[model samples]
Target: MLVHLLYASRAAHTMSGQDLVAILKQSREHNAGAGLTGLLCHSDGVFMQLLEGGRDAVNARYQRIASDPRHKDVILLSYAEIAEREFAGWTMGQVNLHRLNPGLVLKYSATSHLDPYSMSGRAMLSLFRELVSSGAIECS
Candidate 1:
């Protein structure tokens, strides 16, 4: 069975541009080899990620992420068996929320900021879909 997991974590410390780049690079390669696909959004020192794949693979990956030193306050937002992958084409898509339009954020999140902590997992997923559809965010 396939599973989808959404989680939010605070950065252990402020991440520089190079830090984010390195994370994405590693994630893409690792996810592709593991048959996983997902979207990662970063903003205001928080990381929100959606991972979809075989149940074991997704759970294992989430466990690793939860224990990573780079992440703090890891919170599972949602996890469940899903009939389809929402980001199947993306090995590890990335979005820098700071660059996104405020209007789009407000439209879906009722705020001009990317505050995933205040939003439900379903809401955050919808926001990401809208951002992708409107060309406001692109997967790497």
Candidate 2:
């Protein structure tokens, strides 16, 4: 089965721009090596990621993310089985939320931000798509 996991983590205050870049690099390498696909969106000190891959592969990646020191308050948002990969065009694509205009957030999230565990994968991705299409979120 193709597992899709949505998770949020509170980024540590010490994370620098370089550290974010490094994390994205690592995500790309790992996702490509494991044949996983995903989209990661970050905003307001929150790291929300959607990972799609084989059960074992996805779980393995989640374990690695859980141990990363750059973040805390890790929480699983949702998990589901998918028949096809939604992010086939992405390796380990990243979208920085800070680039978004505030209006975009209001349009997609109903609020200025999202609460961890309050949204399902479907709802989260819908919001993600809006932001992506609006040029509010940019790939890294």
Candidate 3:
């Protein structure tokens, strides 16, 4: 069955531009081979990601992510079987919150910032969908 998992985590430290690029490259390659598609948003040392694919693949990937030393306080926000993929066009779409619209951020959360911890998993997913529709996010 197809499933989608949403999770959030804090970076162990501020990531450099090169580190982010490497991460995106590796994620796109790894997810493509694993038959996963999703969106990832990062800002201010926090990461919110959604992974959609076969239940086993998604869960396995999430487990790896949870154990990765680069992330701390990993929290599984949502996980369930889904009728269809929400981010099927990309292996791993990326959104750097610095380039995102402040208004949209405020629309979802109480503040004009990316704080998935403050919003429900559904709210975070909706925000990502809106950003994609608005061309605010760049997909690999």
Candidate 4:
């Protein structure tokens, strides 16, 4: 069966642009071979990612991520069986929230800034969907 897992974590340190690029490169290459698809968002030192694939693949991937040294305070936000993939356009798409509109962020949270720890998984998923629709997602 197909499953999707959403998770959020804090970066161990400030991630530079080159670091982000390297991450995207590694994720895309690894995910494609694992038959996974997903989207990633990082802002204010937080990383939120959604992974979709077979149950085992998704679970194992999450395990690896949760144990990785680059991530700290890792938390699983959501997990569920899905008949379809919401983010299938890229092996691992990136959400460019650098230019995100404040209003869009306010619509889902108490403020204009994103704090995944303070938000519900449902709300974050909704925001992710909106990002997809608003052309805020990018792939490389």
What lDDT tens digits, residue by residue, belong to model 1 across residues 92-122? 8887555688887787676777787888888
Q: Report the alpha-carbon TM-score of model 3 versus the true structure.
A: 0.95
Return the lDDT, model 3, position 118.
Answer: 90
Error of 4 at 33 (Å): 0.3
lDDT of 4 by residue, 1-140 (tens): 89999999999999998999999999999999999999999888899999999999999999999999999999888999999888888899999877577799889999988988988888889888999999999998
Best by lDDT: 4
TM-score of each: 0.92, 0.81, 0.95, 0.97
**C-alpha RMSD of candidate 3:** 1.1
lDDT of 3 by residue, 8-82 (tens): 999998999898888989999999999999988788889899999999999899999999999999998888899
Each prediction's Cα lDDT score?
A: 0.86, 0.75, 0.89, 0.92
Put the candidates in TM-score order, highest first: 4, 3, 1, 2
The list of candidate 2 runs beyond 4 A from truth reads 96-101, 108-110, 114-122, 135-140
Supply candidate 2's per-residue lDDT for 132.
58
lDDT of 2 at 53: 90
- Stronger candidate by lDDT (2 vs 4): 4
- lDDT per residue, candidate 2, 13-116, as tens digits? 76677877887888888789998888877666778888889999999988888997877888887788889987776777777555766565565555766654
